[model samples]
Target: MYAAAGANARACSRRGRSLILPLRPLAWPAVTIRLGHSHEADDVFLFHALTAGKVDTGDLQIEPVVLDFQGLNDKASRGELEATTLSVHAYAYARKHYRLLRSGWTFGEGRGPMIVAREAMTAETLAAASIAVGGVTSSAYLAMTLWNPRARTRVLPFDKVLPAVETGLVDAGLMVHEEEMALELTGLVCVHDLGEWWSGKTDGLPLPLGSVVVRRDVDEDVQRQLHKAVSESVHYALANRQEVVTAVRGTVGGLEADLADDFLGRYITDLSLDIGDRGQSAAEEFLRRGCETGIIPDSLPLEFAPSAAAEPSSSARDGARS
Candidate 1:
C-alpha cells in the first residue's frame, strides 16, 4: 500500500504549480502514494496534471511511474505498486488486493482493439487464422480469445504486431493503442474492431478496457482522497487541452501532436471521470464474459468503489463490515 515517501517531494516540473504550503506544520507527515500508469498517449495526457503537480492531493503526494500497460497489469497482480493502471482481466485476479477506482478507466463505445491484416480477410475467415497478439495478459488478447477461440496466436510486443503482419510473420495481427490510428500507413486493412463486436453483443454498452486500482490495504480515508485527486487531474487536463498535448508530447517522444490529441479525445471521456451506472454495468459484463469463457477463474466478486452518489454492491457493504 501507499505510504509517505518523506517529508517533501523532489519538486515536479517547473511548467506546473507546486503544492501549497500548510498554514502550520501538521503533527502527521504527508504521504506520497506511488502511482503507476501506462506509456500510451491517453495515459500520458490524462496524468500530465497530476505528475506536474497541478492538482491538490491534500495530505498525499502522488509519485508517478510510467510502464507498459501489460507490465503494469503484471505488477498490479503482485501488489508491487500502491496504485496502478491494470487490465480488467488482471483486475479479476487482484480483486482481493485492490479496489477499482471510480475514475481513470478506459471504456469504448464503438472503438477499441483492431484486427489488422495485409490482405482483406472477413471475420468468418479470421476464425481459422493464426494472429499476432500483443500479450496474453492484455485486455486485447482476452477479447481476441473470446471473439475467436479457434484461432491460433503468436505473442509479440504491441509495436511489433503490425510489422510482423506486414512481413508475413503472422496471418493477421491484433493492434491496440495508437496503432488503430496508424493502420493506413502500414497498408493494412482492419478486419474487425473488437469494441464494435463487443458493443453488438451487449446492446451498445461500452467495452471496459482497463482501470485504475488502489490497494485495499490503505486507510479508507486516504484512498478516497487519492481517488478524488486522480479525478481532479483528469478534469484539469480536459480543461487544458493544449497544455496536456504539449506536456504529453515532451514526455512520449515521437508521438505526433495530432495523434496525441486524437488519443486524448478518444479515451478521456465521461467514463474516464467516473464509471457511472452504465460503465459499471459494462464492467460487470466484461468480467462475466471472462469468467464464462474460463479466461478468468470464478473466485473473487467484482467489487469496485462506486461513484459517490451511486449505489454500492452487497459485497462492498459486506467488506465494510469486515
Candidate 2:
C-alpha cells in the first residue's frame, strides 16, 4: 500500500526561465497522484481530469501520489503523501500533524454515517467485546466512541474490519468510507449507523463527514494549485457525473451500475470540494461536542482553516450529501 515514487516526477527547468515545468501530456503541472477510493469527491474530479489530462497538477511540475483514501490518510498523517481526501474526524486528528490543504467538502445534513452489524447483534445487547474498525486512529473508531462510550473498539485497517467481524474477532464495526457501502454486501447485517444515531440524538443536522488535507511541508504555491485543480475536478465531476458512473462502477466491484449512480448521487454533493463556512461550523461543533463528551482529547489541536470563500461572506453552507 506504500508506493513512494521518489524523485521520478521531479520538476524540470527550461532555458532563460525560472523553471519551465515538464508537464508532459498536460499544460499544467505533472502530478503523480496515489488516488483514494472512488466514493470521495475530493479526488473524484482530480482523478477524472488527470485521466483526461484536462488540468495540470500545478503551475510548475508536480505529480500526484494518491493512495486509497484510508491508505492515503494513514500515510498522510505520518507525512507520507502530499494530498488526499479524508474524514473530518481524520482531518481533526491530522491537523495535529499536518496543515489542512483547503476546504474540500462534507456530506450535507441528510447523508450521515451508519454503524451496521449482523441483524442479531443489537446495540442494547452489546457486551464488552472488541469492535473492529478501520485504522486505530480512524474516524470509524472516533464514531464508535461517540456512539457508545463503553464499547471496546479495536482499531484496524478498513480491509480488516469486515473479516475481523466475520471471524468473530470483534462484536461490531464502526465503519466509514467504502466499508459503509460494502458492509451490507458482507452479509453481516448492520447494527447501527453512528451518523444516523447522531442525527437522532442531535435533531436533524447530518453527521460530520470528512475533508482533504495536505502536509505542512508542501510548497504553498503547490498547495494553492492543488486546491484549484481538485476544486475544478469536483465541479466537473458533479456536472458530468452521468459519464463516469460507468467507469467508477468497476472500482467498487459487484455493484449494479444503477446503484452506483444512486450512491454517487446520494453521497456526492455540490459542495464536493468546498466545505466552506457551514462545514467549518459543523466541524467545530462536532469537535466541541466530542471533546465535551471526552470522546476526543479536549486539546486535540483540531482547527478549521479558512477557505477562499470564507471571510467574504461568512455564513453556514447548505447541508448537502458529501
For candidate 1, lDDT tens digit of each residue in 68-103?
887898888889888998887788777878888988
C-alpha local distance difference test of each model: 0.79, 0.57
Candidate 1 off by > 4 Å: 1-25, 306-322
Clashes of each: 0, 30
Best by TM-score: 1
| Cα lDDT of model 2 by residue, 1-322, tens digit | 1222363255445575554334344222233444343344334533575555665544334355545656666665676655666666666556655665444465535545555555566446765556776665555556667767787767676677778777777777666644555655788876666666666766655555666665565544445556666676677677777766655654445667666666666556755656656555556666677788876665344543333422111121111101
Least accurate 10 contiguous residues by lDDT in model 1: 1-10
Q: What's the C-alpha lDDT at position 162 in model 2?
A: 78
